[model samples]
Target: MDYQVNYINPEIKLSNYTGKLFKTEAAFTDHLLVWLISGETKIIQADESFVFGPGSTFLIPRNQLATIINIPKDGLPHKAVAMHLSAERLRAFYNQESIKQKNTVSKIFSFHKHPLLESCLASLIPYFEMQENFPENIASLKITEAITILSAIDKDIGSILANFDEPYKIDLISFMEKNFMFNMSLEKFGYLTGRSLTTFKRDFHKAFSITPQRWLTKKRLELAYYQLTEKNKKPVEVYYETGFENLSHFSFAFKKQFGFSPTTLQKIKTNS
Candidate 1:
């Protein structure tokens, strides 16, 4: 079944985009659900690889690095719609008393072709295609509807989202690799990695010869450079996506390391 997404209406929370046949490295700040309208996607999550085609739907856990390569089928552009669930929004629906928390790591989940979920997504086409700024109230309901349907399929889905347990010590390496894009403090990183500040520093030094701060800067800049020159992404978009707080700071560091600012690099790429 080929679903053609000729219409795209992007709102604050809901996004529709066309994919290119290039591998992209990104981490989701919020839990994300993606529905492929057509074409194929080969995504690497953690150490796992999953392929999806038309009518395929999947959930991507927040703070996980996803390396996605769009595999267009029959010369068709890879189209996808993604819904993001923010921490605040998910917490509003969470109930620790009723939903049992599980101590586990977050990973991607694949879903079979679900008629109800498909229909729900189909019904949203009009809201975006017909008008601009699709009603936030309705958008909120759509997300809620998605959660309900997912809960019916797997009760653990809800629990996995609601529980906020720090990552276990063993899982720290994987968590940091996926989540370094986020502009979180060292203490926060330690907490999420289930380590105290002292322990985190010790473990981090053992894992990488350099300090965490230095490593993070290098990693972010490395990702940003690719996004700008290779992906042709704007400086502002690259900065935000790679976790830089201010453009000035990002630009300063970028110039120092790369010998040119992002804006200059973007222009060079565009002209060439």
Candidate 2:
């Protein structure tokens, strides 16, 4: 896949992709507002998966791990406008407005074809080509406008936008078991679990009685084996989803752990 990004500013961008499906694992520091203009996108979180098509608008809160797949639809390229609502910007807006905080445990919020939001995001497309001349003040206003629209739509949005709290130390074992499918660095995993790198390693060892890397690899391979054998999934389909970066590495690790390649397991299952 050929991917391109046109920046309206540091925080706002137009993303375009032409070709086959592209997948990426990401954990954003700021909330993301995406307005899909064409094609389709699937976002997989630890607990759930969401799919969005053209004219879909969705919000991904900060400090979350997700695997995103972008696919071109029909003959057109996958295209979307994305805006980042930075904590700095949110602080200013919330402080000025004194928005009341509401507690929420929601993961992702989706709005389909909302006229006001669609218009707000659509108005920014022209600015992508004139990024050099785009005024910072206008960009700020656009962000503020988006936040206002979101607040109007969902009164409790302050729980996500107005409040900015770093991840607090949580149950490492439970977090790891639920989220190990994502391909993120150990440091990132530590941060999300509210630990420093050293603390993460120490706590992980205490909990699992094994190093984090070894534990993660073993768990991912085990899941891959089950998917290949019981789910009848192909190696190519299983590798990325099971947290390996590539098929070669997944095959090598699977063989090392199970004494057979993933494809070999599939062949055996098929022959039986």
Candidate 3:
């Protein structure tokens, strides 16, 4: 069977396919709501892991490192409807609320009883099935509708959607430590830390005594090492989670870092 995964544009996306595991070394750029239609979808991040099936909805926060596993049920194609939440569309609805109030962030993943979601999806899926290039306004409204349902259920969610404060540099070290798992360009890392590309390089050297590239590589390799040697995880399982895009790169880096290939851990586990 040929392997394929589709992600067409316009925010409202439909994916129907089958695969063992799809790896993404980078983080999610936008917040997303996904409802599995005909398969078991499993997502694992460094901090959390979840599995969802038919009619199950998952809300994934932006900038979280995750690997998705897709398995079809009953020999059918895996199907899902996903809505990507862009900052622009969210800001429109956010402006109506009190943006000054402080609220803790919503979790990266959450499960809820949202009947509205089912109804909206029922209406939205037909557009995808018909291969219609629907207007952006229509899709944008769907995004707002999802958020509205969320805010009705949880006020904190409303606050998160409303709060779009620009990233700043006051807490550079802390921010990097928290977000380094995201496989983004150094420029993006700089931007998220509220610094220009050049300024980020200079400040990064001052704080860490190394270039951003070297630091990120070392940090990611360290994470892989801990998970492999200490937690006994497989290289394929943790490669994407630790910010490596592919297993070959992960294996090479692992051997360079700790003087042994990642598979050594698995071999040790099997023998002992």
Q: Which candidate is the best by TM-score?
A: 2
Candidate 1 local lDDT, residue 267: 84
How would you encode candidate 1's per-residue C-alpha lDDT over 1-272 as one tens digit per residue?
A: 22233333232222333443444565556787778877787775546678998989888887566666665677676766677777776777664337866765677888868887777776765565555555668777887788778778876787667755445666767777877777777886786676899999989989888899999999989989998878888886677667677689899999999999999988888788
Top-down lDDT ranking: 2, 3, 1
Flag the better candidate by TM-score, 2 or 3. Answer: 2
- lDDT by residue for model 3 over 198-270, one digit each (tens)? 9999998999998888898999888887887788778887787777878899899888987888898678766
Residue 192 of model 3: what lDDT?
Answer: 68
Report the candidate with higher TM-score, 1 versus 2.
2
What is candidate 2's CA lDDT for residue 79?
98
Give the per-residue lDDT of model 2 (tens digit) for 43-141: 988788899999999999988889888999989999999999999999888887776666688589998999999999999988887736678999999
lDDT of 2 at 139: 94
Q: Who wins the lDDT comparison?
A: 2
Roughly what TM-score does model 3 have, to 2 decimal places?
0.83
- Stretches > 4 Å off in candidate 1: 1-20, 95-97, 165-203, 210-272
Quality of model 1 by C-alpha lDDT: 0.73
